[model samples]
Target chain A: MRHTIPPRSGAAFTLERGQRLTVIDPEGEQVADLLAFSRSDIDEVISSGRSLDYASRIFLTTGDALYSNRSNVMLRIVEDTVGRHDFLLTPCSADTFRILYDDAEPHRGCFGNLAHALAPYGIGPDRIPVAFNVFMNVAVDGDTGALAVRPPLSRAGDRIVFEAETDLIIGLTACSAPQSNNFAFKPIEYEISS
Target chain B: MRHTIPPRSGAAFTLERGQRLTVIDPEGEQVADLLAFSRSDIDEVISSGRSLDYASRIFLTTGDALYSNRSNVMLRIVEDTVGRHDFLLTPCSADTFRILYDDAEPHRGCFGNLAHALAPYGIGPDRIPVAFNVFMNVAVDGDTGALAVRPPLSRAGDRIVFEAETDLIIGLTACSAPQSNNFAFKPIEYEISS
Candidate 1:
């Protein structure tokens, strides 16, 4: 299945074992929140801490497996065009808007979009976990150890591909937070296939 | 309503606004994972990051408010018997067992317990967020910046009380991981009242 998730929106789909999902930044400099759960046991969702421990690295690249909280392999990064994805920061939520921008406007965020996307499967707001902020730029200050959210470094058509290790439900949201840049949020393009 | 949660198990209940939930470590050395979701919107669950940001502190104490990812107040700490509670580390999951102990045994962890407890309400694994690791002793090493997991500093009868700011679905899990100590996991007693 293939889809173009509009800005500030999300999409959900089932990706069988051995299948692959490719997330593309069609216009470049756009951010997407990538999340997944085991089809049989949703509790065994992706855990960034486990992945970092298994890989012994802070950032992920091709050949690294995305491990679940159960230490089970969920997805393997088969390819990558951008290598600066963020796994430490949680997804941007409404609270993020209120804190960062001091605006109470009901701006669409990855948290709410993921909830709406997974609602059909009986997943609610409480179930949304921290997502892999794909194509997003976050640099840790070496001296102060502070994380700085920067603009995307990916160019047009830059994408990352992952092969599922088990039957999985995938959720992707085109982040609409203006913190990414001072401009409007852009759409995201993706494809899933066996 | 009041209940005793057995070691390696968990319990779930609904707490309405204006009500208070008090968790007590009767035997004192045991640790518990505390989680909550808004009764009206599950997505608006307790967020440790936001809570820390709101209080501008690392360890939670009395008078600190637990904030949601949306930055809304979920619960306020009305009283605390033990002032050293962890709000940073996510609950111990199966992966924690595999990494820390190399044991593939299906030992109970907070992640599975929370999922199992909330399953009756249609909340599955995907919704289980990082929890407030109440009574667990994790000290960060200043030189190495490594977190050392130690035995609980709480003595018998230690407890913490929180007043619900909104109607909430609360989950509590008794941690059974050997990381606590060589002693067997102990039971936890709690009560909810308006």
Candidate 2:
């Protein structure tokens, strides 16, 4: 089924093992933060560290597997049009705006959206780990260890497909952070296939 | 007073504002995972994203402030003998040994140690975020976005000192992972000065 997550909002749903989820940036230059948890045990959530450790690379694309904290495969990227994504960053939250941007009134951002969306599945803010930022472009300078969040290279209609290796609860957001989405927000589309 | 965190173990303590903490690599080539939480609230813990976001560099040394999830300054590096450290990786855990090393009996790594030590302060396993890895060396290839964990550059008596910016709860570990500590486990020493 096709679903639209409006700009600056999030959604949560369950995907059975072997199901494929395709997340699309309906509009170009948008970022979507994605989180996955084991349907049976919320404690076994997607782990950026384990996935990165096993993959040995930051920019994951088709053929890469997202591993859980328990080191179980959760999702495997089966298809990707935009290959650049960020797993090194925690989802932007109110603190991100208040601290980095110095905004007096900060947006709740993807972190809050995920917490609110996943609350039905017994997930809390503290349980939210670093997210797989689909379509987000983060450039790391190897020489100086500096980081820069650049505008995504994804054009309109770009999508990444992930096949579930286990039954899972998924949280996804059309990121609200200005710096992440090129100072503008746009809706995201997703479809699940058996 | 000097305190020794025996090999592969951890410790937790409270630090009043302005107190300086000196974490020493007493025997060298060891990694210490450090975590900080607000004394008033456990939810406002150290944030790697915030620290690196603000610093614009991954190699945090003297003059850098460790930030909390709530965007507050929790600790500031006042002195550093070895400038290389890692904030991009999560503390090693049982899953790390099992998945990465194929160990049949995986040791409860720094993550477990921190969780156990900080339990008295109401912190749980899920609350532990990416830690500040003291004296650890991590190499990131900018072009490929690849990461490699290398042996620490710290020699005997190398230390990194931080001054508490607020009343804080601290968790420190003499890392148990063989790779992080150069295939040898060693005790870590710490001293607090008011």
lDDT of 2 by residue, A71-138 (tens): 78999999999889998788888888887789999989899999999999998887788799999998
Please give, for residues B59-79, the per-residue lDDT of candidate 1 as tens digits: 677898888766788999999
Q: lDDT values of the candidates? A: 0.78, 0.91
Alpha-carbon deviation at B68 in model 2, angstroms = 2.4
B-chain TM-scores per prediction: 0.95, 0.99
Worst 10 residues of 1 chain A by lDDT: A139-148
Candidate 2, which segments miss by more than 4 Å at Cα? none
Give candidate 1's whole-model lDDT: 0.78
Most DockQ-accurate candidate: 2
Clashing pairs in 1: A125-B43, A126-B42, A126-B127, A127-B126, A127-B127
RMSD of each: 5.3, 2.0
Write one digit per residue (lDDT tens) for candidate 1, span A94-114.
Answer: 777777678778575788888
Q: Against the hidden reference, what TM-scores do the models get?
A: 0.69, 0.93
DockQ of each: 0.12, 0.54
Docking class of 1: incorrect
